[model samples]
Target: MAPSTRRAYATGERSFTCYCQSMNRSPWPASSDLVEDYVTHLFNTGIASSTLSVYLSAIARYHVMHNWPDPTQSARLKAILEGARRMNGVHQDQRLPITPDLLRQLHSRLHLTSNQHIDQRMFGAAFTLAHHFLLRVSEYTSISPARFNPDATLCLDDVHYDRTMLRCTIKQSKTDQRRNGVTLTMQRAESPFVHDVCTGYSEIRRLLYPANFPFFMHASGRFLTRSDVTEALKKCLPDSCDRMRYSSHSFRIGGATAAAADGQPVDAICKKGRWKSASFQRYIRPFPNT
Candidate 1:
């Protein structure tokens, strides 16, 4: 399993163990009745059935690893899981993408200019890159945004620029399970793109962060966090758009949607987004008429 899968499984197992402890039941070698009870207890608490499935899978995997009978294989438990699924189903919220025009508005509204320090400039730059580069917010920012992760986050050295174009390297991504590095390049856009990049570059040397630091490091010596990015985006969103319905991910989808709407080929968008499968289609939601 991948590191993320391991972490999730560990979390599920821990939750189950805690529940078992509270109920005075053995987590390992737990009875089918006990397992059913636990699932029922969790389901009644409004836990999503999908999440409960992970906990059960973790329990099953644990039993397999221990050479014990898999309690999750019980027909009764399976029925309960199915029942939970039927009861809860899937609840999805529609997240609007941040289209190109909206992105331009964000830059303008943030007042990203020479007078603004890198702290203020960081949002515009980060937002622009994620849109243009189809970057996951996690690929550029830290897991928690407040800390640093040289192995994954965008470091200053990972980005390069020239008169005609800007190039970036995404060192890690969820899809690149093999840890292979991926690079994204974008030719400089019309006026504002050049201005944003130039302004950010001019401030980097004067700022406290070193060459090895995160590219979007705040003036306060912290990497620009996800919360900060979200807050900035929400601040600049047009009055008609619901800020609560979008997130850092909206930029990636918005870019893809705009590209498609502008007649960019699907294969080209797929390549630019580094998507190995046609799953990228789902990200390109219908661009609103607004």
Candidate 2:
């Protein structure tokens, strides 16, 4: 199983165990009626239907792993969940993509100075690389100790420069369970100003770290964390309510949206983003009129 799947199952098991303990019920060999009651309890607590489904899956997986009958497989339990979904609705909030205009604004604000030169250059390169490559924050930065997979992480050696193009090899990812890696290449931006900024950042990165070092680093010499990247990107944007909607995911969403606006085919965008399924459509938002 993938590390992420294991983590989700662990979380779901914990939640179900707590629920069973509170009601003085046995989690193991739970009856369909008990599962229905648990589902109803979760629904009443206002958890989204999607989340409730995960919880149910976890319960089912737990039973299957132990060679026990899964109460979640009952038609009655499915009906309860279906009812909850219809009652609560299933819309999820979509994070706003950081468009090219927003990226330009961010790039312009990262001015290099004597005191903050290192930070400014690092942030600029990280931001530019993320946007151009359509990276998930976790793909580039260490997010949590428990979830970090060294095999999937990017190190300095993974990056190669060939003339004006930068090729980055991602050894593993959420989708790559077998550890077969993928290489994503981005050419120098056509705009001279953008090209210069990207080139400058690469130079700074090379000067500061050895070839084997983590590609993204903090000032203290540790790998950059997801929170660090999020906080830094947030500071680059203007202070506004919309800023709150932008996160590490905004880079991926923005890149897809920008590419679509530029007339790139969906298949090309999927190949660039390493999306295995049509789910990439979720990232392509309609470009707003300026």
Question: Of the candidates shown, which would achieve the greatest TM-score relative to the real structure?
Answer: 2
Off by over 4 Å in 1: 1-6, 9-93, 111-116, 144-146, 189-208
Residue 136's lDDT within candidate 1 is: 80
For each candidate in the order shown, give its overall lDDT on alpha carbons: 0.76, 0.73
lDDT of 2 at 210: 71
lDDT of residue 135 for candidate 1: 85
Per-prediction backbone clash count? 0, 0
C-alpha RMSD of each candidate structure in angstroms: 6.5, 5.5
Which number leads on lDDT?
1
Off by over 4 Å in 2: 1-6, 12-47, 52-87, 111-115, 143-149, 189-196, 287-290
lDDT of 1 by residue, 14-53 (tens): 9989999998887888778888898888999998866887
lDDT of 1 at 242: 77
**Per-residue lDDT of model 2, residues 22-45, tens digit only:** 999988878899888988888889
